[model samples]
Target: MARNDGYEDLGAWSEFGTVSGMVAARTTESLTEAHTGLGDRPDDLDGLPDVTVGVSAAEAIGDLAAELSPPPPKGYDNEVDADGDGTLDDATYRGRADGGVDILVDVDGDGRTDFIGADTDLDNRVDHADYDKDGDGVFEKRMFDDDGDGFLDRSVFLNPGS
Candidate 1:
């Protein structure tokens, strides 16, 4: 198991015989199970060594689904009140260890989520977002990182002609 705590460096290491269920990281700022020391071992490793180097950071921590558990939803204590009503109408869900966050906003204070911003890949950046302009259970605008470069580059409108 390889881990990074954002304060140490990870160098190349060689493994010899029959490596199975190996989670290795080559970056110095990755959050793996080895970093937080929390999570359960995966059940379906194919007996091949897994290396998380130049590929994707998600590849390094994907197996630790149980490790990157998200926290319970709570009130979003920010200053952006879309409806301008004094009461905050947004709630946020964050990861317990990894750097992932999801914010749900009720624009009209109607108890329905009209906007969602998230960093689903744990990259400390908002790479996906959905906007339900009317808060009627359907998103009208969506943006996401189609290339997985940790940036939201693609945008689509659900009702283009509307």
Candidate 2:
């Protein structure tokens, strides 16, 4: 008799007619550990460890369900402070369902806003304090990260990319 290999079930298009992808991650811990000692071991999915310590397949099932759950709207992780003044805007917050665009705009029509868009860094909500050493329009964007953090996240360049 041949040993039963794990199975994968996939689904497309939710019942409500919305686009969705579903994947069932199944593993047999007892089977995986038992097979490792055998000379004629069946194929195993290495990406997912067969023996998840004491973690049962039931737990993995719940995790799969959570992963299959619909994704949240964009910038869901970003804590926006449109009302930096401790107030909420009457206009509906229009954050994207993807985490790409996380920008805050003045919603209350108040002239006093946090960090001018051109300022980039919200230091004092103004651009004058930034290193505009060259008096050029593209200030500080050319700065390099000597520490190599993939950004000018810290420190400033005097005349980078000039």
Candidate 3:
């Protein structure tokens, strides 16, 4: 039901509304299927709205839910071979609501985090990092952005065993 004249307009509007509607429709279908075991009866009709209105309201609520959802996290490319072993290690991504992303890498493949890279300003730049340089499962170095700028302005070193 929405119209767009150009790519920019389309990009600005995105597909959240349509996606939400689809999600709601699927959800409704699943719920209906799950509840079908309850035999049809005239008395049950009084408590529920008409199907069309219920679907419309569900879609509107889905749209609101989609708007409130957070962006998906991003992963690092294969270019970052930190250990120089010519193989990529595993990593996880978390998105910040205000801005940017946080990446946690398991450099040794031991199922523990070894490094964290963050872009707190959403500028596609690394503004902070915490590293477990000794690979002992404890972070020993912290980099920070002091002025809210997309740049690391200070570094603090923690005890090796801490």
Judged by TM-score, which candidate is best? 3
Q: How accurate is candidate 2 locally (lDDT)?
A: 0.35
Model 3: ten consecutive residues of lowest lDDT:
75-84
Candidate 1 residue-wise lDDT, 10-98, digit = tens: 43332322132243333423654344455677866797766646644433443354356666335333323333366655554545444
Candidate 3: stretches off by over 4 Å = 1-90, 144-154, 159-162
Q: Write the per-residue lDDT of candidate 3 for residues 7-101, one digit (tens) a residue.
A: 44454346776688899889997784555565775565477654564344434553455467565444433223334377754655566675566
* lDDT of model 3, residue 62: 38
Off by over 4 Å in 2: 1-48, 73-162
Error (Å) of candidate 1 at residue 149 is: 11
Root-mean-square deviation of Cα positions for candidate 3 versus the true structure, in angstroms: 24.1
In the range 47-147, model 2's lDDT, one tens digit per residue, is 66677696555446635654554443443332333334566333222222332222334343532222212222322121221232222322352232334
Per-prediction TM-score to the true structure, in the order listed: 0.36, 0.18, 0.39
Q: Provide the clashing-pair count of each candidate structure.
A: 0, 4, 0
